[model samples]
Target: MAAFPYYDTPAIDALNAQAVALLKLFAERGYVREEPAVLQPAEIFLDRSGEEIRRRTFTLMDPSGRELCLRPDLTIPICRQVVQEGRKFPARIAYNGLVFRHQPGEPHRATQFFQAGVELLGLEDRAAGETEILSLTIEALRVAGLKQFSLRIGDLALFGALVDALALPDGWRARLKRHFWRAGYVESLLYWLGHGDGKAKLPGTRAEIEALLDARADAPMAGRSREEIISRAMDRAVEAAALHLDPAVADAIAKLLDISGPAEGALISIRALLKTAGINLDPQLAAMDGRLATLKSLGVDPGQVQFTAHFGRNMEYYTGFVFELWARDKEGPVQIAGGGRYDSMMEMLGAKKPVSAIGCAIRTERVLAAKIAGGA
Candidate 1:
């Protein structure tokens, strides 16, 4: 088999052309080109990129026993560069590169592909920042000859605010956040909350958990010693209560997730949910409105954008505002581009302080495939 994919003349040319055009857009907007190393520390991804990406990552060990992997995505490696180099804030950078992924038994899945996009770092004005990133992505698609696409937007920060307002137990907050993006999982979680056997859904009574920690008091796990585990469990005793979800709060969350349509209509539904929950989310609502206004000012029709509460795309680092652009096809809608804000990623990559950032990428292969199919 070939070391890498072999593309025919037309497809190769198309990829090259799309990359150049997309990079030009970024360049004109002050984003300098950046290319991170192809091989990176595997743990960086395994620890931060979420289980979906982790499972598909192509990992290996070097001769010296250093764990390494081919880059699964450009965003993390680029963020790693920014933190390591102490790059100045408000930096605009772009990259056109290949990312690798492999599945054990899925031969037909894409193993590698060309991706081109930009990341805007340290822009604190979120409304303007989101608008800039979304607009740039749309323009890049336009340059790639894409004409019709649906923009689906979601805000994790908004969802987080609602969860906080609900006053869920600390342990349950983590569990719910973990499943926030999975529509089915979230629905089931809400069900468990409204109708679970009291105390049975917990990891065990506080004392039982502590006893296990004490018994394994010498074994180490994932870097934590048994003593450390016991101490941690002791700290978590208050949080590990039975799964008790208030029926009203569960209904509110379900309603929020179900609010999907034009931007304005979604906002209306969100406000209703907040009112029913007796929570004042003025600041978050204002931020969402600001983003919508920013999008409108960028020439996108607010009516065309669909906003939803549970729209995370499985990228673990996306701290707020995720979106995907889809084009209609004979089979259904196919995503051509997607990305979002990941303000905490730099910290995850070892930064000493918080860093603000947002970015998106276009799949050159997918764009070309759509073009050839005459569907997008």
Candidate 2:
């Protein structure tokens, strides 16, 4: 018979040692190390996580019949810990633990995974916090023996601004943004913008017109016919036209769709796009730009890092920057580490104030696999 495999294998031992060393480094940096409970109240996760996440959580009843769930992610539970303990702001806490999510028949995607990260609370300096989190992530990846990975960053705030600039109806705006990252929806969006194949129908336009017409017909004018109301609605449509595309709005959308090149070039293009759109460079945005400049000054090659405008992870809670590290040549499940900013999460978890939080989880098995494949 074949020899039984042991968790004490040299490869696994090496990865664990690296993880412990990184954890110690984080602790030395004034990050309060805490081991979070592996299980938590199911409701806590269900309330904050998006619909897709809620479905995947591993849940069961406790001894007293209280619903319990194996932690799906650390951020939410950390928020819960803060709320329960009434922790003060500007608090820096770090945790290293395994989280469980239910996945049947998915061997590579295990139900159990390790998460190591920090949450910085009450930091009014959003940009500083974002920069620190990203820096920490890069450092962790380097320590974990991942050297040839590029950071793909994006801002939901910029995307939100583009949406507001469009002046699209509320329903349409919501629908379009919901489908923005979806594959095969680019043509649909272009169609909605009156540029591509006009296949999909916009709902409720006729109903809205009919409602306006009926109200006008019932107004002070006595015995007004329905035809008059329809005529008035048609006049309104002709005057307003079909949501004329503002040049600025067009430029913003174009920028988001234009995902190419390395980080520096992307930033230059983004700045130009914003300038053409007449968007005043807000201090928050400026600070982010400055942070990138600092990173470049530190000898980090901007050309080596890709900034994808719409490259968001599947997670919905990421409010600011999001990134994934991948091997330069590997194709399947290439992620080595990934995380982003989640400012509003504490509030979502019933905390008194917003927590300025960012984190990255390194997939140890994947890291080891890559290292071995690279003959490291």
Candidate 3:
């Protein structure tokens, strides 16, 4: 039998050294470094993450028959620690570890990968917290010898605001937001609204019921009862089919759909669109505006940084201000570091109250690869 290959590569060792140095710098800045366990309960992920993530988790049963999973990400488990240990507010926690995910037909997507990140808990001021997180991420990249990267920032709260302002029905709003990433579905909505497809349809069985009742006025009560049952089922089916959206709301969403540009310009256009629709902007969003102004004052040009209005990472636990750092020259899947505010996760993990939080994870391999390519 052939033996499995065992090799120690210099590139891997250098990447590890770079990661350790970065973590040490974070620790010197008073961040608590943790080595989290490799295995965790499967329920922790399924309960907090979205369906797509849940499906991708690596799950198995233990010898004691409890279902367990390899840790897919470190944030949730760290939050769980805060809950179980009853940690205090404003905790600055950092972690470096390996995570696992099953990817079929995508061999390049490693089943196991390393992650390093920090979570700031119990900071209620979203704007201040967001700015700090962003700054820390930029510094981390620089310390790791990375330059020439652009940050793409976004706000999911803005998307929520658009949904609420348009007065879309609960179900349709949910469906639309859920599928907002799909261009075809969004276009279909526009087409439907333009063609007057918002009219509600009456079920066919209701007409049959009226006709039968008229023709057999003296029919037995049991036969009438049978028709009523069939009619009720048909009514439910009709209600289900009438899930089309309101035309005005559709128009509002269509306007929102086109909102993407440089940060300042996009904000101006969005505010105008909301005002024209008679919807007031949320005061909390003003904080984000203020932070953006601060960044501008600090010489980070809005034109250089792409600000997407409806942008979101795949994580559902993120509550605000998600961002991804991408190297300028990298083309495919160019995320070296990413994180966002996840204030509610600790409470969901059974903490006494909401612990405000923000975090970012650097894919160490990608960071080193970019650095080498840049001749660092």
TM-score of each: 0.84, 0.74, 0.79
lDDT of all predictions: 0.81, 0.67, 0.73
**Model 2 lDDT tens row, 105-128:** 554456676667777767788777
Q: Candidate 1: deviation at residue 162, Å?
A: 1.2
Which regions of candidate 1 fall more than 4 Å away from where they truly are?
1-5, 103-106, 169-175, 178-196, 200-245, 328-332
Q: By TM-score, is 1 or 3 better?
A: 1
| Per-residue lDDT of candidate 3, residues 101-177 (tens digit) | 87766655667767888888887776777787777777888888886676677877666666665544576667756
Q: Score residue 27 of candidate 2 by CA lDDT.
A: 78
Q: Higher lDDT: candidate 2 or 3? A: 3
Off by over 4 Å in 2: 1-6, 9-12, 61-67, 102-106, 168-244, 247-255, 275-288, 328-333
lDDT of 3: 0.73
Identify the leading candidate in terms of lDDT.
1
List all candidate RMSDs to the true structure. 3.9, 7.4, 6.7
Worst 10 residues of 2 by lDDT: 195-204
